[model samples]
Target: MAVTFYINLAYLLGAIAFVWGLRLLSTPDTARRGNILASIGMGLAIIAAMLAPLENTSNNYGWILGGMAVGAGIGWVSARRIQMTAMPQMVSMFNGLGGACAVVLALVEVFQFYGGERTLDSGQLVIVLSTLLIGGVAFTGSLLAFGKLQGLVRDNTLTLPKHNIINQIMLLVLIVMGVMLVIQGQEAGLTMAMIFTVLALIYGFSFVIPIGGADMPVVISLLNSFTGLSAAAAGLIYENNFMLVGGILVGASGTILTVLMCEAMNRSLLNVLIGGFGGGGGSAKGADGDQVAKEVSINDAAIQLYYSNSVMFVPGYGLAVAQAQKVCKEVDDLLEANGVDVKYAIHPVAGRMPGHMNVLLAEADVPYPKLLDLDDANSALPNTDMVVIVGANDVVNPAAYDDPGSPIYGMPVLNVWEAKNVIVLKRSMSTGYAGIQNPLFFHAKNRMLFGDAKDSLNKLVQELKNL
Candidate 1:
């Protein structure tokens, strides 16, 4: 019992470390250190868990050890081998696994209670129901998000008529079933638990499927919150302080991120929850063979911008994929040295999340003054000599202006189309994650440079040096 007290105290200390790590993670400069601190805390928590006594006659220790070993090995390999491009999918899977673990814990505890007591008391029933509902929702929703991020499923919106009404009705039924389970407390409890799990799984899928790729980051963050909440519910059931604290950290951070993302898009969290922006509508896709825009060599683009007075650079997810921020900054520096003013146009929802583009650029030590938000950049576009669209698509699409039936027609965009000259870097004329072709590529003023982002940027950098 004394040992148990010591182990619990140590676990509490470890949990505090997790909170410290989260605080450090708020800034890019400290993010690496924060992750290291968090890992150390987790290691300490594992030791405490392993040392906790479960009685000599109990075989639970062996199962715990085996499960820990297997999970650790898999986590190690996955973290070491995953590519940066596939990080989103990896995050979803990891979060999903955490949720699944909570679900298993809840179910195991329920089975144990039923095996002996044969019927759950009201308090136990509530705990079991909460864990099942939260865990089940996180599990299935995370899987669907993972599928979308991995391109295993269509990234377009999945919606049907009267979807909101149906979702509401289902929620009401699930709540009623949960209450009945608590009151009935025997055969009905187990059956209701199963039904609640099923409803949760369906609701999870329904909640995420309508969200488009553009909102995948927010969806992932929200699911992460759900995972944490599920873990917290399980912790309450099992009386685990470490689980409660860790889950609270995850839930808090995830919620903050969700709010930040919502603000970046100038949308309320409720609006996003109601499924308006991310969903696909009946917007018409552009006609095929619409590649009227001409592809230019690195030399041509360099020449066009070399003598320009001012240039605005627009970056998107491709910049992060290429990890070309440093290269981009170098080009900007060279342009500035030659009396060519260079500025960055950052879209609000650019890259995979809010401020993702800004973070990547800042990592390369780009000047803070040079970074311009959508509105600021839009105001400067008409006066700019050259607007460089670096691995961007949807943000500058001209169809948004003339095509009233377009999915993104009403959404605000950068005024790059109004710039004097537009140069775009891309691999092909393929549409963006929104699953729609950008009419900006077909604009007569826009010139495309086809190749890998880094390679193209590097070539253009070299070409500019020669000029």
Candidate 2:
């Protein structure tokens, strides 16, 4: 009784830590502390769980410790080595592993019941089966997303003939199998569970493959929510309060983030799932068809920056691709030293994931207060003296406002064109992930600075120092 009481107490404390940690994660200032708190809470929960009574008489701790050591080593090494460019793929892989863990636990519970070593009520059985289904889908779906992001699988939408019909059929089959499993119970349900798992895995892969690269952030958010819900189901099966609370927090937060991302892109969740936004890289030719982009030399660009009183830096995936966040910060620091006010404009959907730009900039030691969101940055742009667009394209495109027939017509973009002078640094005039050209390049206020983002920023830093 004392052991049970202590275990419950630990779980309650862990739940509180998780809640506080999640609350702190809402703001950039406390995000690192929040992560540490959450890690500590998870550690406490794991320790408490290990101390609880086990069903079997196997007292061997070697296997468990060995597994923990291996997992910890791999995670440490991976986190240390992964670049910001591959962070989205890494997130996908981690979320998938969480789902896979839930699936494995569910399967183990079902097998134990089948072997007569344990007995579960109908409610428990249902929870276990549900966890299996949701976790299976999340696991396979996340792996496919990781593959797409890694360039191992094609990033473009992969659709079969009558894809919608096939998807519906598969879903129906899964539903039927789930019903059979529940009805059959302990006697004949094992086979049905296996069949359901297979169908769920296939459905997960099929669901994610049709999504294009532009929609990956939303997909990642949605899959994260799925994994959380699966974990919650696992918690219910085990009657673990800590896991239940943690899962609920993750599910709620992930769902909110996913909705925000969809809103940021001015897209509906259903439309994103149906998949067709980003096709091939096709440049839009509107009234700017005859307008030629004027290229500016690094020295000339530096002169503009040096004279400007206020500058806003807009970052995108190109910044990540060039691994230029550090040098970008160097430019900011140099400009600040010259008494220039510099700020970073962060679009909600910038880069491949939510908070991608924030994370990169944070690593470069950019001040949290200096990072402005879409609306805030837009408000500041009109009065700003200069806008330095570093490897950004579609986010600052004037076409989002001017072209009614464009694919990203209603999406909210940074109003960089509203600034007095705009200098865009890029290797070429290629379209962004949305595969659409940005007319902002041809705008009168904008000048193209064609080069690698890191090189251009380095040159800018050198010029600023010379000044």
Candidate 3:
């Protein structure tokens, strides 16, 4: 009885830590501390579980410790060594591993029930099967997301003809099979469960495949929710309270973020799940229209920035690729010293994942208050004298609002063109992830200063100093 009491106490404490940590993570100031607290909470839960006595359980310290050491070492190394550019892929892969863990746990319960070593009621069977289904989807779906971001999977290979219809059929069949497993209870054999797991995985790959690169931010978050839900299901099967609470928190947060991002894109949840939307269909007479984009030299752009009453810097995936966050920050600092008001306009889907640009800027020690979200930046744009688009593409595209026939039409984009003078820094006239050309480049008020973003930024800084 005392052992049970102690276990419950530890679980309660862990649950509290998780809640507090999550709350802290909502803001920039305390995110690091929150992460540490959550890690500690997880550690406490693992220790309590290890000490808890259970039937037919031989706690092999060597194997368990060895596994823990290896996993921890890999996680630490990967987290430390990974560049901000590849963060989305890393996140996708790690989230998949979490799902894989839930899969293993569910498989153990499934095998035991099928072998007659254990039995469960209909409700319990449903929970076990649910864990398997969601976990399988998360595992393979995340891998596909990772592959897409890493360029290992080509866009042409992502979808089959009429893939949407195929995905719908698979989903319906998976649901029917899950219901059968629940109804059969102990009567269901291992073969049925294995078939269900395989189908779920296939559905997962198909589900993510149709989504375009532009929608990756939302897709990754949704996959995270799937992994959390599977973990919660596993916890329910084992009656572990801390696991349940932590899983619920992760699942709920991930879901909320996904919905919020969809709203930001002015898209419905159904549209996102439907999946054919983001594959950019090249639009004619939009950004690809015959208007010639004007050019600006580094010296000229620097003079414009130096004398501007107010400036807003817009960044995109290009900024991340050039590893120019520090240089970007340095440029902003120089402007600030000259009494030039500077702020950064960050689009919700600026990079490969949500908060990607924010994380990169944060790494360069950029001040939190200087960052302006979509709404705030839009409202402030008209009064701004100069808008510098650094390594940006679709987010600042005028076609989002101008051309209804465009693929990203009606999508909420940064209104950088609303400023008096617009300067775009890019290596070339290439289109963005949405696979659509940007009309903002051809806007009468905008001028393109073509070159490597880092080189241009450095040269601009030199010119600013000379002036």
Instruction: Say which prediction, candidate 1 or candidate 2, comes out ahead on TM-score.
Output: 2
Reference-based TM-score, model 1: 0.82
- Per-residue CA lDDT of candidate 2, range 1-467, in tens? 88889989889888988999988888878998998998888888988888887555785677888999999999999999999999999999999999899999998997888777888877887898889878888899999989888878875546787776787898888877766667777776566667777788888888887778778889899999999999999999988888888888888888999999999988899888875566655456553447789889988988889888999999999999999999999989888988999999999988888899999999899999999999999999999999988877778877788788777788899999889999999898878887888888888888899989998899888988898
Q: Which stretches in model 3 have alpha-carbon errors above 4 Å? A: 54-57
Residue-wise C-alpha lDDT for candidate 1, range 147-239, written one tens digit per residue: 887778774346666666777787788889888877876757455566677787798777776677777777788889989988888878867
TM-scores, one per candidate:
0.82, 0.96, 0.97
How far residue 359's Cα lies from its native spot in candidate 1, in Å, is 7.0
Give the C-alpha miss distance for residue 83 in model 1, angstroms. 2.0
lDDT: which is higher, 1 or 2?
2
Which candidate leads the pack in TM-score? 3
Global fold similarity of model 2 (TM-score): 0.96
